[model samples]
Target: MKISQISVFLENKNGRLAEVTRILAENNISLKAASIADTSDFGILRIICDQTEKARQLMHDHLFTTRVNDVIAVRLDDRPGSLAAIMTLFEQNRVNVEYLYTTHIGQEQRSAVVFKVEDVERGLSILRQNGMETVKGF
Candidate 1:
């Protein structure tokens, strides 16, 4: 399964991140998972929210440059080697992971990993054939 993730490009300055969070909160967009890759000048803020299209519109209205990407999330055991095993699977399948981030599924003690891979559908299929559970929603 693939999830819609919005990425906002922002300046790497103090309060820039806070400002985005505040805007989303003020607009009632709840973040399910998020990640930020920063450089000296700017940063790419990737966000998975309940209302994806609404969030994108809000970001655009705020004058922030943004884009939507399709990512895959997999639920796995929260323990050592769990991540390694997944990577191994990807390697065997010749799938390249451009980037990844994790979120916890509380109570169940499972870890939900969001992956940006070259082939989203292939990644999902590989995880599925290996008995991995793919996250369908936030």
Candidate 2:
């Protein structure tokens, strides 16, 4: 119903993103999905990984600012308007989505979306009621 996501604050500079990936690779942390939202000064690197706790610990040890939070991973049909349909469900339920990212898990006809919402529990309930399959892990 919920998945752990790590958000790392990165300074907007060359090799900063590489540093994060390098650290994760060195520690064997596999990324399932990732998204970066950036401004002029910094960026938020949001990632879903195979190992959440270890990734967070490694990032912290390497002196990177990181935070762990739960996001809903909803399984969706890989077709037109699939995302719009899900957005409609959330909108009708009054659940605000802060952000979202998509990933495919070895399925050509289906994909999963990770959504960060205002109320995770309520969002999950709404999505479930709407017949959306929510995944548990990356």
Candidate 3:
């Protein structure tokens, strides 16, 4: 229903992002998807990787502040009004998105959009009842 996304709390300074990537690279963890939200002082690095638990432990061992959050990943047609259709469902169900980020996969014909909703279970159930497909796996 949902996937574990690695959220890293990092200072908003030069080389900080690179350091995190280096750590993951050294451990051979492949990043499948990622997003970042930042402020003046800090940033949250939301990442989806093949080895989530291992990535979490590695970050912890390296003294980096991180957490694992359940985020919903969905597949959507890569065309106009695709997203609008999904949001319409949430609006109908009164589900607050809170925050969301997306990435594209495949070519222009088909693609996927991953989102982080406020409530995982409720969101999943709503999506299911509405016949929305959820992306799975690490």
Candidate 4:
């Protein structure tokens, strides 16, 4: 299954990140997981939230550059080599992971990772064949 990730293009400056968070907070949107990659001039803030479409629309209304991307979320065991095992499967399948972020879910001692890959369907297939569980929602 594919998860919706919201990516916001932010200018690299003081309080820009805070501003984004403030907007989301004002709109009552909660972030489940988030990651940011930055350069000298700008940054891309990627987030998974309970209210994805609403968050995207709010960002748009505020004139923040945004886009929705499809990413795969997998439930991983919270132990050494769990991620390495998954990476090996991806390597064997020729799936390129563009980027990824992880979050701990509940009290199950499991980690959830959101992966942005070159091919979503192929990656999902490979993960499934390897007996990995794909997380569907928050």
Candidate 2 weakest ten by summed lDDT: 104-113
TM-score of each: 0.94, 0.95, 0.92, 0.95
Residue 82, model 1, lDDT: 88
lDDT of 2 by residue, 1-138 (tens): 789899999999999999999999998888989999999999999999999999999999999999999999988776799899999888888899998989876534458888999999999988877778898765
RMSD of each: 1.3, 1.3, 2.0, 1.1
Superposition error at 1 for model 4 (Å) = 1.1
Can you write out model 1's per-residue Cα lDDT over 90-138, one digit (the tens) per residue? 9999999999999866546667999999999889899999998888886
**Candidate numbers sorted by TM-score from highest down:** 4, 2, 1, 3
**Model 4 lDDT tens row, 32-81:** 88999988899999999889989999999999999998999999876899
**What is the lDDT, from 0 to 100, of the residue 85 in candidate 1?**
94
Q: What TM-score does prediction 3 earn?
A: 0.92
For residues 1-138, could you state the per-residue lDDT of candidate 3 as single tens digits? 788899999998999899999999999998878889989899999998989999999999989999998888888876799889889988998878866777654333345677777788999999898889887763
CA lDDT of every candidate: 0.91, 0.89, 0.85, 0.90
Pairs that clash in candidate 1:
none
> What is the clash count of model 4?
0
- Residue 34 of model 1 has an lDDT of 90
